[model samples]
Target: MTTPLVEMLDIDKSFPGVRALSRACFELLPGEVHALMGENGAGKSTLMKILSGVYTRDGGTVKLDGKPVEITSPRQALDAGISIIHQELALMRDLTVAQNIFIGREPRRFGILDEAALNRDARAIFAQMNLKLEPTVRVETLTIAKQQMVEIAKALSYRSRVLIMDEPTAALNDAEIAELFAIINQLKSEGVGIVYISHKMDEIKRISDRVTVMRDGEYVGTVPAADTPIDTIISMMVGRTLSNETAAITDTSRNPVALEVRNLRRGRDIRDVSFELRRGEILGFAGLMGAGRTEVARAIFGADRREGGEIWVGGKRVGISSPQDAVAAGIGYLSEDRKLFGLATGLDVRNNIALASLARFTRAAGVLDDAGMHQAAEKYIRQLSIKTPSDTQEARLLSGGNQQKVVIAKWLLRDCDILIFDEPTRGIDVGAKSEIYRLLNQLAADGKAIIVISSELPEILRLSHRIAVMCEGRLTGILPGGASQEEIMRLATLREPAMEVRHAG
Candidate 1:
């Protein structure tokens, strides 16, 4: 039997209030793609961080080529032929491709930067990858797919034999994904081992040779990817079988219009977008990336100033110049980048939950009623099934799903009648996604109008009463629930005038 490229055994790691990993183990063979599958807090990333030398493991035995070695820093790991490409690319956008790739290890002649040698070295790496990218072009000028290729090229520049990719396709379109897969195949043929960390199920089946499952900081099991069913793998990762049923298309046509937008416009981001969201309905916004779905949401929520548009709340035309005004009109927006715009990570869960409704807990003497805030937080934590040790726990300590639930709790506490959830389950796992879907359904059933903007077509099909498709900042068409993926894609790519805007009677 050939020696394994990497082997980890009995990995244990802990933080201030969390045991991130416990007796976790993983292995990768040369020329193999091993997938690390788990939920948000399942310790997959922590284990990988230890391997990449970003964090020192409390206890573990790691072997490369059947010999144990201690890797305590990223530099050490790089020297040992290991490299990590994070989901958020780390390239310097202002620098040229060659400069960004060889930033620290630039070729220098008598202490002067050797620009010619640097570009030559970068071009050599690109040629090895069969990638076509100008070494002199600024990193910012390239598309995300190209930037990702640059990241991969940087990894190979280190002559790395083991590469770890975390959610590499999260931001990539289908064509870009195909391109990335081709590169992965080429690398595999070169006897390089890869540890692919992704929540996307289909991707695991398509690219990985083996699957390792982790749950709640412990190793669950590992199985051959081609032999194991997706549902079985999901069950292993989440410890239960999640319902695969699509949501029943509820007839909300008779419901009153809770919100309406007429000619909503933002510089090229949004173009004369018009739609009416009825009470007790989930209106899904679907499009390719940069189709202006988020732009329309931001304009409606007053997070961005609209150049021209009319917004009506409860049949009354309202001037919403700022988020405060939108909030006053009973509108709440859950931003796609929740950590940046939704929750204060450093604050306790209780305070974060009550952030939007702080006034409700304020006393006449200008003092905050802490007990009232705690009670409200506790109520929603239970109502939303947020898994936290207590309401006083720091928001950042919770898993991605729990953090999202906290954001929802905040808006619910604010008593907003119209909700805009942008990418509600972007980074969440399968189990958490089911929970969020249930919550959104319950919210809509309770008469709160909802607009969900998602890059995923399945999510839109699963939850929306009406699927609204967009293309190039235009509302191209609205299809009924259960519409085929082909129909949605056609509208998503269509640039011409949309099919007649249909309003529910």
Candidate 2:
């Protein structure tokens, strides 16, 4: 057998408040897809960053094809045939696809950008991937899936020996994700090594040849994907056996409609979607990504404008022209991109929790009430069991789960009756996910109309009183909460023969 294409030995890295990696080791064979699994802030990203030379390792050696080498910068790593695609896309939104793809290394004919050659090369590559996209299309105009494909195309252009994908399927639909796996398989066949970083367990079993688990900045163990059970892998990642704690929701009969959306249409991306959220109901929106699940949530929250729709809140026709309008109408939105939209990373806990309801904490003289803010923050910190040394801890320093709790606390403090939690537990660990689930149940019990859009089927099946399936920009079906994963997945991907009415088993 050929020597492994890339091998990291005893890597150690540190930051001010964290020892991100400790003697971590990773190996990738020339033609194998190696998956890296870990909870958020478990040093998976840190290790990969060190490998790609974005962060220099304080200790340990990285070997390229059995030969140790110094990779001090991104350019050096790229020259050594290593590339990484980050979770938050790094593309310039205003630039054209071709320009963004070939940004720094644009081919020049006589010292000028070879625009024709750029588009031609881009088109050629896209054709190989079975993607039909105009190279001149502004990245801002394209959907998230299309932009993800662009990121892949960019990574491929480097002629990389080892490619690292961090949550590549986070925003991709089933079809787009399938296309990506096809390309990954093709790359594997062509002797290119891959490092897949994802939280989705099923994907690990499907695509990975080897699974590496990391916890608290240390390498746990490596195992063959086929031999290791899903629970075993999850257990290793969180350093604890996770007993699936998703509780069966109680029957919520006799609840009145808290929110009713009718003919919610916004351009071609979001079709005629309509649904009613009942008080004391956990309604789940299930779909393959780009099924307009998030779009529907955004439209309902007034984050995006709907061309035509009628919304009634508590029997009153309401105008939801903006997020502020929606919020005023008692709608709260927890966006999918948490870091970008959810928290103020630099702010302390007391301030973050009080952010949404600042006016409530103000004195009669219009001055901010610091004492009230602290007391309110303290109440929630204990109520939610947020892990923090003090109420003054920076939001950025907290773990993923705690950060999410902070977001929830913000909305809860604002007294928003209708909450839209989009991928609320995406990067949160198993323990924290359970906590979030319990919190959701409690929220529902307290009569908050909850809309949860999660990609994970088990989550949708567990906490939802009703499940709504979406596909190709439409609500396909709504099923009872006791539905199985297959049942929700089938309807989520189902197109023809719309099952609008819930069918009894």
Indicate which candidate wins on lDDT.
Answer: 1
Over 4 Å off, model 2: 247-249, 269-272, 345-350, 364-405, 429-431, 484-505
lDDT of 2 by residue, 1-505 (tens): 7898988999999776567789999999988999998877678888998889899999999999899988999999999999999876888999999998888999999998899999998998897788889999999998777888899999988879899998888778678888999999999999999999988888889999999999888999999999999888888987775555554566655688899989889987677787788899999989887788899988888888899989999989999989889999999999887777889989999999999898898888889999999999999998887877678889987766678889988998998999999999876766667768888988888989999999878788888888888888888788877888887778777774264453321
The digit string of per-residue lDDT tens for model 1 on 317-412 reads: 999999999999999999876777999999999999999888889998889999999999999989888877789999977876678889989999
- TM-scores, in order shown? 0.91, 0.90
The residue pairs found clashing in candidate 2 are none
> Residue 76's C-alpha lDDT in candidate 1?
95
What TM-score does prediction 1 earn?
Answer: 0.91
- Report the poorest 10 consecutive residues by lDDT, candidate 2: 496-505
Q: RMSD in angstroms, all models?
A: 2.8, 2.9
How much lDDT does each candidate structure score? 0.89, 0.86
